[model samples]
Target: MQPPTTITRVLVIGAGAMGSQIALTAALAGHTTIVQDIAQGRLDAAAAQLRESTDKMVKSGKLAEEQARRAHDRLEFSTDLEAVAAAADFVIEAATERLEIKKAIFARLGELAPPHAILATNSSTIGSSAVAGASGRPGQVCNLHFFNPVLVMECVEVVRHAGTSQATVDTTVELARSLGKTPVLINHEVPGFVANRLMGAVQKEALALLAGGVASMEDIDATARMALRHPMGPFELMDLVGLDVVDYIAQATYAATGNPADAPDESVAALVRAGKLGRKSGTGWYSYSR
Candidate 1:
């Protein structure tokens, strides 16, 4: 399969969990992928992860050695955002989920990237139009939001904000197909798009139950496992997602909707305050070594 002409070389900003996964997926799809982060340590980690991840695919017989090598060969890592963005055909911002920070990043991207290049964000919320509003070229900016564990989850929500042009959204969906991901075209800039909003509703219900003393952690988990058939319960997912991220999403949703109750249950605030930010921090509702 050939990559879309507009996204043959992808620049993934902030090469952390989701960012590195984007790099791996694009490279595997035969696109030149450059992953840039703020720090050298993160770049090193992403490179190592890319190698290991592709090598695992090869060993597991999912990818041949040559194909895995090609994927690894197409990946580049850097700490300089401007340098890479300037050369990229597509730029995906997977940075911190702050409106100001993302706005600032896109502002730089609009200035650095070619005017025709697609500039998309992997933002789950905070709205693409708002991010593009701060950019110099709003037409090139739209939401190319990918689900977590980007390699595993095939869903990519192609969000076209009021400011986004039809071309941008069309090319983004093409890009998603190039990477072998399924794209769901959404014409409006709804907060959390479709998936997150649905999950948020269920999450609110779960948290309310916990807050209302409807169930303990164990009971709720068991119920989800036995009855709901969910791979993991809401609290388990909360812990895996990191309380800080949950807080960020909740706040963004609340601000987008102006619903005070849009935020996650009060327990998450207490968890964030205590610095139990979940998997990345090794604890949230539980502790572990990763």
Candidate 2:
């Protein structure tokens, strides 16, 4: 356990959609962030997207051009994994949510990264302990589960495994604050942590209602928006989060609790199978012309 020191150089591995947003947040927080991806196109696209997001903030008068420039200055894109792993003070792995892929990254990272560097994963539902178990340095590992649209969201789930040290956990929470995110600590290793579990429950109920012909999708959405004052109903929210994510959560939840409630509703599986992968893929329960 090291003291709660400032994160000097942050490395974000895997410049996917979420990874890009995370790297932008870290860079805007004034830390040197190296964003890397296995594919050159992904790295380039993520870098471009980060620039666009920050530029929008600049145009909105939230940040001065010089500040934006400085923030962008802190972010560098690379296809080189070894370089980033060796130099980062803190590394956030945002690769695909597959366990095998994550394990492979951590195994390589365990060999490459400095001993003092803290490793974090952006996994929403996977057990931090399982991920850390493959890390080989579980004592220096923890979960830094950032909510999507990380550049705008303010909450992070700070999770620790059995072997995670108090120092590593504290340093991560402190870093979360520094990045302007509220950190919620989890005492036990639960799949989906806190947010995803609650969200999955709500959506599963919504799906059961739909499947039972209780109401049409529009009617349910209207009820949530008007009666509950929710920005979006279950289906809409599910679309925003991506069907793949919800499916992952449900599977993890059922595995963790052995509860039928956590089982994936047939409707969700159908949507994913149809390649209606939600907003990013252009459709889900809602139609997106773009």
Off by over 4 Å in 2: 1-4
lDDT for 190 (candidate 2): 80
> TM-score of every model?
0.91, 0.95
Could you give candidate 1's per-residue lDDT for residues 1-290 as a string of tens digits?
12245667899999888999998899999999999888999899888887888788888888899998888889999988778888888888899887789988988888888777888999888678888877778887888888788888899998888878777777899899999999999888777789888777767888778778999876887788789898888778878777888888888888778877785567888989999998888888778788
RMSD of 2: 1.6
lDDT of each: 0.84, 0.86
Per lDDT, the best of the predicted structures is 2
Candidate 1's C-alpha runs over 4 A off are: 1-6, 287-290
Give the alpha carbon lDDT tens digit for every residue of 1-290 in model 2.
46337788999988888888998888888899999888999988887887888788889998889988998889899988898789888999999888888888888888888888898999887766777877678898888999988977889999888888998988999999989899999977887888887777778778878989999888888898899898889889999999988887787778778987668777888999999989989999998979
